[model samples]
Target: MQTDKVLLEILNNRFSAIVNEMGYIVYRTGFTVFVKETQDYGVGLVAPTGELFAYPQEVGVANMLGMPMEDAIATIPEYRPGDVIITNDPYTTGGMCTHLPDIHLYKPFFYKGELICFLWDFIHSSDVGGLVPGSIAPSAYDIYQEGLIIPPRKLYREGKLDQELLDMILANCRIPEQNWGDLKALLAALNTGERRLTEVIERYGVETVKQGITDLLAYGEQSARAIIADIPDGTYTFSDYVEGDVTTQIPLRIKLALTVQGSDMYLDFTGTDPQIRAAFNVPTFGKTHHWLTVGLVTFLRTKNPSIPLNKGILRPVHTTVPSGTLLNPVPPASCGIRYATAIRVIDVTFGALSQAIDDVVPAAGAGQVAIVLISMPDYQSGGYKVSVLQPMQGGSGGRPVKDGIDGGDFSAGFLRNIPTEMLEADIPILVHKYMFPDDTLPAGQFRGGLGVDFRFQVFTPHCIVTARGMERHRFRPWGRKGGSAGTRALTKVNPGTEQEQNIGIIDILKLEPYDLVQIMTPCGGGYGDPLDRDPDKVLKDVEDEFITREAAESEYGVVIRNGRVDQAQTEALRHRLQTSRILKPFDYGSEREEYEWLWPPEVQD
Candidate 1:
């Protein structure tokens, strides 16, 4: 038996509202810009079983939807009313606390001396004692290089702060004060969640709220399956890549064989390449991890926008995450840049899904997030300062009926762009051209989103810049139907000058004073054929400066004369272009096409 359908929805919204409030509290009270500006944090309510019953949907990072908390919660079996657990060790917490930079914490909620639930939260705190500034380096060879690993332990005990534990953690960070500030903000947010949840428990009665948790989870499972069952039941397979590691040209390949049978979907990654020494490992603990199942989540959410966001959504999804693969790496493997591999996993997962439901799926979005990080020495205090210069993101892929969002990628749509004034106030840099390039992919019916145009000049000497998640350079985002691929990411130093140098996908760049770096992120891939695009839409793009007049004529087969459509010329151009070549449903650009021709997916193990 279950609670009334209407009552369950009311309870769901109540729980969701609490977590969203928790997230907003953190954002308002946080000391770090990563929390205040980018909203790179997560908070949720967890049942005693450790599965998240409620998660913040409107605020914070939505990537941890399916993150398993059973292992992390089991560490400290006996928890008092005010006791809390803190961890950032991926290995120790069964990948629950993925990566060291993401400092995670959870506090038990008690009602009438009985533990009712737990409120969990995490912030992507900058500089957790790593070899690099932001504690993330794609070139990182091992976990030790990433940062300090705090196993699941008591951050607070018996309503008391563990000063020793706190000291040990803050001692290892580059910006200890800022991290402590963020920790306080998390604590404040958790308190907010506890208070809100307590009010609901008080109003609805403890038993009802407790049962509501169980009922809501089942409801979530049902809702997700309802959406997923709509997807055609079949086996679809696809593979994609992360450019390469620091030392090797062999790219990190993520493969997926998606099998949809009724309401359930099984993701088999048996043939994925072995994990590398770099920080690209996903560390999923050889199960269906949240990081691995993001593509399926996107599908469910996109297909059924009203589907509840909770652990129940994962009930209908399972995975065969083979050990030693990029998705499930062994211990000591560098997993700091695990998100890089996960994004590619999302791509392959979508790749397989597109074969099943082509019209429902959009073309690829900006498959990367290049967050500009800077670590410099403070001249006044003679201390070190680490800060995020900006999070430059690519655009989302063009959809069937709508254009992709400019400067917003599906992977990072939740995160907000940091203001130029704020970044300059903290760092010795002048941000210029922090806007969208007035151009888009000539997708068939709609244009793909225009990615960010982030350019800045560093004024402080020997300032280290680490732009992690810089991808889509070699292989661009693939277009669906007859649409063309999006543009590739480009990094140029002193453009249009004698000192111009188009430096490709960077790792950690060191700059002298007054060094200007311009990073133009890749746009999303388009859907359908360019020639099939509405001419008025093409002209609007021209008037809006989204595409050049010459490009409108050349790419979209839309010729214009004196601001009006050249009907005769347009017809002839479209005809010539249409009959020129047989269009492939997917346009993966030249690099992907050439590489696949040499090493095909069908032939691979």
Candidate 2:
């Protein structure tokens, strides 16, 4: 007989607490800045069959749901009760750890000599011995250059740490002590999950606990199906582009054609660009994978905050990924910086769904990671030191209901910029300005938020600043339903100087004493018609220096006189704009026309 619904939900809620408690122990005992402050980690409980049973909803990384443990478990059949398996291989882990920087650990939970569940955890280590200190670079061409890829092995056997394996890992990375601290903390976190999970089994009986996993997964499946069933059944296609290849100026195209029939959805990625030589390939293994649906997942997680975390939540969705494309690349394709392409995947998905849900979808966003890497050479140390100088990002696209968040990281939500003080203390860099751009927001009924304009000057003579995945230079973030496109991003060296350079995309330059690096991050696109916007809001933008008076007159059809909007002139201008008989659709720019041609239905498949 099945248990009561209330009891099942209560146990599920308690199971969530157990995982959260597990995540906290890692943060409390971990030693690295990544785990302690930045908190780039995750924890969860797995059924004996390797399906996810319980996950931390509020905390922990949300993207680890696709990780596969059955293969790893098969690779090592014999395991004691306290034995723990460790791996960082992207292919071996079944896309669990997307890259080598994220080290994954799993411990078997046994009840009377039979394995009942698996306690799983992962943390992005500070460094693994590679061409770069952080084990990630746009320049790296393959997985080999990224770092060491550990196969599934016992990190701990019978509750005792494997000294040889630990030594091998510590010796390969630059920060041994910090890595060890993080590893120990992970083990401790798993132990917490183990203790609480065993207690659950003891109280409810193993059979009931096993049945709870099935109940929770089925609940999530029902919720997801209900959401998809509301959308009209039809085929919708959309496409977007990455800024460019790191080694080339040609923009990489990513296409998506979504078909929603009944409660099922399918995403086809046949016309996407061939994989590049650089590090921008997604390693999803081509399921309704996490990389392809992070935006929708975030939306669902936010809306249904209490939904259970399991594979069934994603059962309503499926994907068709072509080999050698940016979404699913063949071997030797560098994948260290795959998140750049991941952003385009999300944007394309939204583009496909716009036809079905105009109000639910907004416009395009700054679809690139504003990554900046800085390195300093110390003569006394005799080696180069590296640090991420503000993992900065721009705003998201404005929604139909409201404006996007200003100076926000889109896909990697909850990840923040490293503090200026931390950068100054750890690395040799001076931060002069870190604030929102003065007049970067796009104009509409709902204006897109502005991006951060960070100014930094190098103090060290032998320092270098390199960056990748910047967009909105040649093409702007496009708006929808008569809204205006957002302003483009700019990267320049020493404004007003005759020798200043306007860098478009992907550059590695040496820094001098007086050299400055200024990044004007991209703004999000607006929603609805600008002519329909409030006159007072347009006046405020002009007065507050968010947009120029000329911009209001030209784009929004609102006239300003003596620091205020002229009501009579604005009314006349709005009328003129409405009757202008413009031939251009709202998405009129390089971003739309190019992708439209590249991903036509005939060319697909």
> What clash pairs does model 1 have?
365-397, 439-546, 483-528
lDDT string, candidate 1, 1-605, tens digits: 37888888889999988998999898899999888999999999999887888988888998888898888888887999888889999988998977889999899999889998899999998889888889888788899999899999998998899999999999998898999999999999988888998899888899889889998888889988887788889999888889747658676678888999999988999889998988788889876688888878888888888888888889988889888878888989998877777888888887899999887778888888877788888888777888987777898888888887888988878888888889888777888778778765546566788888888898887788887788888898988887788888899988878988888877788888888899988899888878888898899889988899988987889999999998999999999988887777888889988888898877766
lDDT string for model 2 (63-172, tens) is 66645556666777787988999998877755665678889899988988877778889887767777666777776788888888898899888988889998998889
- Model 2 poorest ten-residue lDDT run: 581-590
Clashing pairs in 2: none
Q: What lDDT score goes with residue 462 in model 2?
A: 72
What overall lDDT goes with each candidate model?
Answer: 0.86, 0.76
Query: On a 0 to 1 TM-score scale, where does candidate 1 land against the true structure?
Result: 0.97
Residue 95 CA displacement from its true place in model 2, Å: 1.8
Measured against the true structure, the TM-scores of the candidates, in listed sequence, are: 0.97, 0.92
